[model samples]
Target: MANVAISELDKNCGKVVAEIVKLERKIFPKHESLASFFENELKKKNSGLLYLHVDGELAGYVMYSWPSSLYASITKLAVKEQWRRQGHGEVLLKAAIEKCRTRKVSCIMLHVDPLRTPALNLYKKHGFQVDCLVESYYSSDRNAYRMYLDFDSS
Candidate 1:
């Protein structure tokens, strides 16, 4: 069996951040990627990253931020192409939600491309409901669904 682990990314871990940046570039379009600003984002008190490793190799990560006590946003979730469809994304997502739960947040929100079926399914399976269709959320050609999981209602 593959050994799996999930842990919060430490701001001081430069090597890990670099690896994540490389992975981010591969997974997201340049205009939509937060890779260039990831380190800076991590430095913020309310922002953090959770990474999942399979057999000691980075498989996926989730970036989240809580700008206010009552709400949190999941800005990114990406699994390596080879690791896709293997439940790594779900694991990382669960970890991020748990982190928000521990902080007593009332709602967790995220935006996903409407056309990304696998991702939309994953979020829906975890109780995230579409609140609205965000036109041009990603780019001129791409639209997104603004989804949210309300802990108070669940």
Candidate 2:
């Protein structure tokens, strides 16, 4: 948490997407669409990404979307393998949640694969609850659980 600079996200934004592809071990966004998608979205929102850096190296990245909605959606979040279990994920999420709350967002939302136990647990520990399950949500070959956190809890 002490070694994070949200501004450095763009440097390794694409890498974070690649890392997610590796970590999830699922067929997703083989092309650079995911990475490029963030660029476009961020540009549209006039917002930026939040980056987590550890030991002077980029460790993770998260994309936040706040489109006149009450909830800020976490479009993506991923940490490098070596940086996991060090509380970086929590730190990144905290930063994002705070940012949204400061902007008057009522809540934060994110999605995780039901099969990803660790991710589900992490979200739960951070006050995110399974709001609902989206059938065939991810690429029609996978399902995703939408999680939400009320800003008042922060």
Candidate 3:
């Protein structure tokens, strides 16, 4: 079995942050990427990042924030293309949810592209329900689903 581990990323860890930024640029479109603002996002007291490493290499990451005491938001979730479909995304997602649980949030929410079937399935498997369709959420031509996982129902 491969050596795998997940841990909270420290905002001051420049090397890891740089690596994540590089991966973000590769995985997401320019307008959707938070690569340029990652460091600043990490500096926020209510936000944090958790990363998964496979054989000591970065495999995936999830970014989450509890801006309000009542709820949390999963801002991003990404797995390296090489690591896709190997359960890395699920592991990272579960970790992020657990982190939000620790913060005593009632629910966790996220926005996802409706066309990304794998991602939609993954979130649905974890009990995220689509609350509404967000028209042009990503762009003029793209729509998104606003999904939420309520701890109270779980």
lDDT of 1 by residue, 1-154 (tens): 9999998898577888898999999989899988888888889999989988899998889999999998999999999999999999999999999998988999999999989999999999999999999999999989999999999999
Residue pairs clashing in model 1 are none
Q: Kindly report which residue stretches of model 2 are placed more than 4 angstroms away from their true locations once superposed.
A: 1-33, 152-154
lDDT over C-alpha atoms for residue 37 of model 2: 52
Please report, in order, the local distance difference test score of every candidate based on alpha carbons: 0.93, 0.71, 0.95
Which 10 successive residues of model 3 have the least lDDT summed? 7-16
C-alpha lDDT (0 to 100) for residue 19 of candidate 2: 54
Range of the 10 consecutive residues with the lowest summed lDDT in candidate 2 = 24-33
> Candidate 1: minimum summed lDDT over ten consecutive residues — where?
7-16
RMSD of each: 0.8, 4.3, 0.7
Quote the lDDT for 91 in model 1. Answer: 90
TM-score of each candidate structure, all chains considered together: 0.97, 0.77, 0.98
| TM-score, prediction 2 | 0.77
Q: For each predicted model, how many residue pairs clash, with residues at least 3 apart or on different chains?
A: 0, 1, 0
Best first by TM-score, ranked: 3, 1, 2
lDDT score, residue 123, model 1? Answer: 99
Across 5-24, the per-residue lDDT of candidate 2 in tens digits comes to: 55534544576545534543
